[model samples]
Target: MARSKKYFNPFKPSAGAEPPRIIGRDQVVLDFVGALEGGVGAPARLMRVTGPRGSGKTVLLTDLGSRAQDIGWNVVNITAGINMLDDLIHELSPDSSVDSLSVAGNAAIASGEAVMKVKHPNLRALMKRCCGKSKGLVITIDEVQDAPIEAMQLIAGSVQHLIREKKDISLVFAGLPMGVMDLINGKALTFLRRAQSEELDFISLIEVRLSFRDGFAVSGLILRDEQLEMMARATAGYAYLIQLIGYYVWRFADLHRARSMEVSDEDVRLGIENAMTRFHEVVHEPAISRVTKGAMEYLVAMAQEGERASTADVAKRMGREPKATSSFRRSLIQREVIQSPVRGYVEFSVPFLREYVLENADELLDRY
Candidate 1:
């Protein structure tokens, strides 16, 4: 019988699986690695690694935590927010009552020794044993924007105290663009300047030259230079995009071997199509629903026009005035459903989200 064929899945990492090998981020790795290696004499002041949503900020933080562990530093990763902080602390601390307050206090104590000095006797007792001679502990926060304001305050105060006491403790906060703004604008801003601010962006040309080939090798695939360019263009050099592409490509290759006993470019093209379909199904559909469901009809209309609609354009489009539309636009911006990509252009940063809204929103677009 003729051999069957295999296909690729572009959305392989959609559910938060790590790429078997990280590619095209050497500089970021080096910078985070330096922090992990304690290049700072004391616990480096609170540092930040910021990027957009779907930019792989969480994965990078997770990777850093793993690296910190390899180097023998105490590491904590939190995403469930301040409510979970106590539990996290408890896990690291031995003498803690089940009482929430007491557990938080104890965890704080345990973490104190590992990264900063402990003030509470409970924490102090734990740290002396846990921290030993280590200079500091590493705490990494993912999706920091989701954290409650109170939690943010408490964490900021904790680190500030550590700094005041001349103890060692360092932090890594990763999140979307606004998360960076949150860190830089509020009380956290003052403390951040005292430490370090490293912006993690897409892979540079130099890094691509040095590391991209090796990364593909590790994943057991081969790509022509033109194919590489296609991926880079499609993904905009976003870290998550790289992994998403790599994963689907690997799956494609594996399937080809299983069925056809061969892999080819047509298989790659099939993978890309499947990936785009999956992207529309898995991510874009739900995002569009949540954003438009509660929004006013006019706002949904504005979103469909690519968020780049001018105030005048939006009013014209909505059969209203620029003056009336301003308030509506402001609300969308605040809710983060739409954004001004530059000073003038506005668009949905999330892939296909706006397109979905446009396709479905009646009167959002004029008949053309």
Candidate 2:
């Protein structure tokens, strides 16, 4: 038999990079594809996925677009921005380049220098023309929150008319929950509320475990049942953690290269510690920095309640009545910082956010 070759690190912990194995999102992809195959009138064609940062929204968007492409559909993938409409026009067909002419800025006269002039291609018309060349079309936009309301209006109106015409078009987008909610509630984009909405969150621990098994197997590391479970538990069912912790764990084993590629418990211990540090800097710090002082106070109060806490209890801890704190709760929920999993109870939405708060309480409180 041939020797087993050692594979390069299989985990992808970086933001927006597609992991070798996409766990727990199989159904979402299947649903998008099924809806696309169902043709124009399918309710799921216009879809939006929302989750907190590092929740795999970008990777899912790429996977969805790829699946559509596999079905012979033309895919136009873009990140929503002020120039989203122009970007779409160019992506759909670069040949539909903007008209250019030399113009004067100071006076209404021709200038010696040439200026780039956008013809402002009619996205609706351009989409229709492009559709004629393919079986169907999929436009996947990520970061919908960054998209201007005006740009959203043009795109939504075009898709609305196209759907009315029964064109085989699919519009799928992804963004953080806060931004995605704002977009859907926008007057021009309200119709998206009727579109299929998938909340990308933590993958199941079981799913993460199985993914770890397969991913680590390729790297020639031997992990026992409990060790694997430990790895999965460390991930806390968070999709991004699967990559982060796995990368560190695999890295530890690779560097040691002793004991015949067997990953010892110390490797896992060190891995978790290193991963937590990076996570604190990359994820937690930025997330906390964006919150208002009031929200920070609310978050710290919730953190004192441990992994899950009663909303009333949290309000009391903050020295406020439940009614007085309701606004903070609502805003936090909208911001994807805290989630009310059940009535009257709330918890931090991002994994380890509570710990991050508790550990850095002094610095955070002083800053806020």
Candidate with maximal TM-score: 2
Worst 10 residues of 2 by lDDT: 105-114
What's the TM-score of every candidate structure?
0.75, 0.87
Error of 2 at 274 (Å): 1.5
Candidate 2 lDDT over 231-269, as tens digits, reads 999988887788899999889988767456788899888
Candidate 2 local Cα displacement, residue 179, angstroms: 3.0
Model 2 / residue 187 / CA error / Å: 1.1
Candidate 1 local lDDT, 81-165, one digit each (tens): 6555565456557455434332223122213312323333333334333444454566787777776654554555566555456
Flag regions of model 2 displaced more than 4 Å: 1-6, 97-120, 320-331, 341-345
